[model samples]
Target: MSFAERYGPWAVIAGASEGTGREFARQIAAQGLNCILIARREGPLKELAEQIRAESGVECVTASVDLAKPDAAEQIAAVAGDREVGLYVNNAGADPNGKRFLDNDLQNWVDLAQRNVMTTLKTAYLFAGPMRARGRGGVLLVNSGACYGGSSFMATYSASKAFDLCFAEGLWAELRNHGVDVLSLVLGQTDTPAYRTLLAEKGLPLPTNWASPVEVAKVGLAQLPHGPVYNWGQTNDVAGYAPNSPDQRRARVLMIEQHSRSTFGDD
Candidate 1:
């Protein structure tokens, strides 16, 4: 069966204004699923919608709203209207300033938590219900390798990603019997605009292992049937690492500290 037929006729891609999210919107539209693109930036979202409509001839709706807002999920649902949204790509996430935990103000941490954790939770809760009722659907939660363990300069960011990783895994188990495929998309360094800007700001070179957003999106979508968890580029052996071992944990912390200092000049 075609992807649209198997899942549903429509897919909602959060954070679809640029980068991997844009690639997801394009690819899903190519697969014949109408797309609802959500992002904070209206210009980019409208441009992407136009491009998708022009290229794939698929219907596209753009929602301009900050996912960090508590009611983002409801707003997205309202834009989706009565469409059978079969696939939801929860790609929107907060980017933390690469600074020590104490360096950031309390409100910054709160905002990051809301964007990364609360919004994702709300989106899943709102979308998954309809998917379950329909008996066939998919949810892709975009996570990061930072989820493996505590990151020194990225403590809260990593914690939020860990939440996403666990949430997706648990949902996969619970929803499998209901014919809803849930995937935790564990990404390594990707060559996205935001990542590039970060590198430039830090005066660091791009990592050789960086995957293109297009490649990541392609692999992620194709591997939906194989999930619970899919790690993009396999850059980190997250599954093989023994986090509980004292020696390994110590080594991991040392590595993170050294890398953080070297890359971001964080002590």
Candidate 2:
């Protein structure tokens, strides 16, 4: 069956204004799915909706709302409103508090938790039920390499991604038999506007090997059938356990700490 027949008619992409989320919307629309694009920026979302409609001739709806808001999931659901949303991509997240744990304000951390953790949980709860009831759907959770271990200056960010990783893994097991596919897309540095801006702001150079958002989206979509977890460009087992032995995990943590100090000037 074609992708649309199997998992679509409609797909919802959170964070769809740009980068990987935008790429996902484009690719999914190309697969013949109508798209509901949700993001904080109305301008970019509308532009992307227009582009997708023009390019793919697929119906597109743009929802402009901050996913950090407590009622974001309900707002997205309202926009989707009875559409057979066969695929939902939870891709909206960021580390707003870039300072060290103690240096960051408590409210910043709370906001991060609400956006990264609470939003994902609530959105999944709202969307997954219908997908399961229909018995044909997909959920893709965009996670990061920071999920592999603790990140020094990015402690909360990493922890939130870890939650996503674990959540998707559990859902994969629970949903596989229900005709629902769940995938945790574990990504390394991807070349995106936000990431470039972040590097520029910190005076850090972009890595030559950073994955493109388009490539990441393509790989992630293609690997949905192989999940539980899909580590971009990696063939090794990435399920369960930290991708390292205990000693290696310790070494990796130290390396991350040193990198954090060098990058952020944190102790």
Candidate 3:
């Protein structure tokens, strides 16, 4: 099936308060679908839901959740209840305390993993079974450009995203013939409150060169059911993705490491 046909007009987005998640909500609403918004901050989620309802006339449901505690995943998965979930956009994510690995709070690292990976996994595991039973479903996992070689200061965040990227692909392969379209979006730096907080924590002095959430959401929505992972549009991304062979991929990894050091190192 085509991309549009695969996704239809329904979506559920986590981290829906700001950034790519919010953009996804808007775009999907415009696509003429109802939406479910999940995030810890209910105020913004409610505001966005109201905006989408008023502007796009799409039904919006808000679930204020901190998907980091034990059993949080199961609780989140239970929301679907009797409804068949058509599109699951796992956009919820968190960064570690922004300290170095040695200085970072262990609990923060654990929270990052639970929120970013565990929650997405639970939702997919629970909802996909039903969607597959119905012979249709689309899963959108929001990964990051930081998941490349490795991350230094933001090690936990990067590792969690890597899990997201890999899991999306593996699951997609399993569900393809079953009409399940699983997608992993490898997003670059985006202009959002979360990104701002992270940059401030990292003390990056350089000017921002980032992509918009709208662009990320649009490209992601266009590419699912075809494969697992896709890098969003950005001119510089060409150089990063050009590497194909295993050796070349290694070279690419090294390059990412070098650039990351330069970009994040104290000047």
Candidate 4:
């Protein structure tokens, strides 16, 4: 089947206002799927929706709900209405406060968990169930290189992203035979608006060789069927116990999964 036939009718993209999320909206729409755009910023979402409609000639829906809130999934569903959503992209879970764990407010970490962990899990449960029944759909969880290991100032962020990575891997195993694709798109130093803003706040200049959001989005969609995980750049491919090479990680997951199935009899 074609891309649209396999994962289309409609695709819901959280964090759809800008950067990689915006590019995902564009790329997915270009491939013939209508889009439901969700972000806390209403203006950007509406602008993107209009652009997608005009450019791709596909229906566009917009929702301005904070993904950190408990009712985020409900708001998204209400916006989506009864559309048979075939793809769900969880991309709203960026770490806003790039400070030491103790330097940040407790509430900030909690809200981060709500956005990155709780909301992601909720939306997966919401959208993936129907997709599995339909037998052809996808879930792309945008993740970070920090997930590979802990960092000095990225404690909670790293931990939450690790959760996302493992969750996607497990989901990939469960849904692979059911015709639902799941990917953890792990990124490193991408040139996103959010990254620029964070750098500006810290009085730092842009890096010379950051990954492009457009290319990242393109590769992510192309690699959806081959996941478990996609480590976007060599920044993640290191010589250590926790190597972040996509092929290595994929092999490890498959190996462990085979062992589990053999031991537990695929119950």
TM-score of each: 0.87, 0.88, 0.83, 0.94
For model 1, state the Cα shift of residue 96 in Å: 4.2
Question: What tens-digit string does per-residue lDDT give for candidate 1 at 1-267?
Answer: 678886769999999998999999999999899999999999999999999999999999998988888788789889988888999998888473777789989778877888889889888888899888878899998888788788688999999999987788667766776888888887888888888888898899989978899998999998786667776654233444423332233345456556767777742
lDDT by residue (1-267, candidate 2, tens digit) is 679987899999999999999999999999999999999999999999999999999999998988888999999999999898999998888674567988978878877778889999998888889888888899999988788888788888899888987788667766777888888888888888888888888889989998999999999999887667777667634334447432333344456656767777742
Residues 13-114 of candidate 4: C-alpha lDDT, one tens digit per residue: 999999999999999999999999999999999999999989999999888999989888888888888999999998888886989999989999999988
Each model's C-alpha lDDT? 0.83, 0.84, 0.73, 0.90
Q: Rank by lDDT, highest first.
A: 4, 2, 1, 3
Model 3 per-residue lDDT at 154: 71
Can you tell me which runs of candidate 1 are displaced by over 4 Å?
A: 94-96, 235-267
Which candidate number has the best lDDT? 4
The better-scoring model by lDDT among 1 and 2 is: 2
- State which candidate has the highest TM-score: 4
lDDT of 3: 0.73
Total backbone collisions, model 4: 0
Residue 147 displacement (Å), model 4: 0.4
Show the lowest summed lDDT stretch of 10 residues, model 4.
Answer: 234-243
lDDT of 3 by residue, 50-122 (tens): 9999988867888888878767667666654555468888887756376777797788888888888777788
lDDT of 1: 0.83
CA lDDT of 36 in candidate 4? Answer: 93
How many clashes show up in model 2? 0
Model 2 worst lDDT run, 10 consecutive residues: 244-253
